[model samples]
Target: MPQITFLLPDGGTQTLEAGDAPTVMHLAIRHDLPGMPAECGGQLACATCMVDVPEDWRGRVPEASPDERDMIEDRIGSLPEGRRLCCQIAVTPALDGLVVRIPERQG
Candidate 1:
């Protein structure tokens, strides 16, 4: 199992085992993590599941699709170099020990 770590906005940290779920949103929801709302239920339709992939892991992860990028641009207005929608991320073996930061708000 891949170990995924989440750095919450409150300066708290959470780690969990990444199982069969393809997206981080699924893992967050499964574990009842508070930082991610995932309003669109792992769909690219919502930006509420945004997470900041740490610099070291960013290049290892997949890039956002054009539609996901548009949503981030439209909803967030500003995109950080590490910005990512958790719904679009798959929990892969290569992502083991991945660290992510949860934004304060996803609105």
Candidate 2:
């Protein structure tokens, strides 16, 4: 199991044990963390599950797929270096202690 930390929009931090969750989005939705609406669930359709990965942990997470990058660009007009759709990030032991900041609003 990996531990994922969410930096919420309200300036609060939430750390949760990711247990058997398949992805970061699943863990967020499971915990009902603020700022993660995930309206389209884990599908790649909605960009509602966006989160900003800190620079220090960026290398630990996989690079976003081309399609994922396009979707984010389409929604936000431009892709920031750390912005990612949590649904696309698979949970694994390698990602223990991963930290992501939730945007103030979903796309």
Candidate 3:
């Protein structure tokens, strides 16, 4: 199993052990972590799963697909270069101990 750590805007953290199958958004929802609504159920059409990949881990996560890229740019609040939709990130053993930051707001 891989471990993921979500750093909430309020300075809280939620860590979970997940297998290499679930998407990051699914992991968040499964653990009942705050800040990721995943309103579109992992579809690229919604950006509710937006989160910022920590600077050091930016290039470690997979690149966003075109559709996800466009949707994120249009709907997420201000973000850094590595911001991405969590739903598009597939959990993997390599992502063990992966860390992501929840933005202050998402719309």
lDDT agreement with native, every candidate: 0.87, 0.94, 0.84
Clash totals for all candidate models: 0, 0, 0
Provide C-alpha RMSD values for all models, in order: 1.0, 0.7, 1.7
Model 1 stretches with alpha carbons more than 4 Å out:
none
TM-score (C-alpha) between model 2 and the true structure: 0.97
Per-residue lDDT of 33-94 in model 2, one digit per residue for the tens?
Answer: 98888888888998999999999999999999998999899999999999999999999999
Q: Which residue runs of candidate 3 sit more than 4 Å off their true CA positions?
A: 77-79
lDDT of 3 by residue, 18-104 (tens): 854479999888877877788889867779888989879988898888787788767754445888999999998889889999888
Compose the digit string of candidate 1's lDDT tens values, residues 1-107: 99898888899889999889787889888988887888889768878999888888888999888888888889979777889899899888988899998899885
- Model 1 score (lDDT): 0.87
Which order, best to worst by lDDT? 2, 1, 3
TM-score of each: 0.94, 0.97, 0.91
**At residue 48, what lDDT does model 1 achieve?**
92
Q: In candidate 2, list every pair of residues with a backbone clash.
A: none
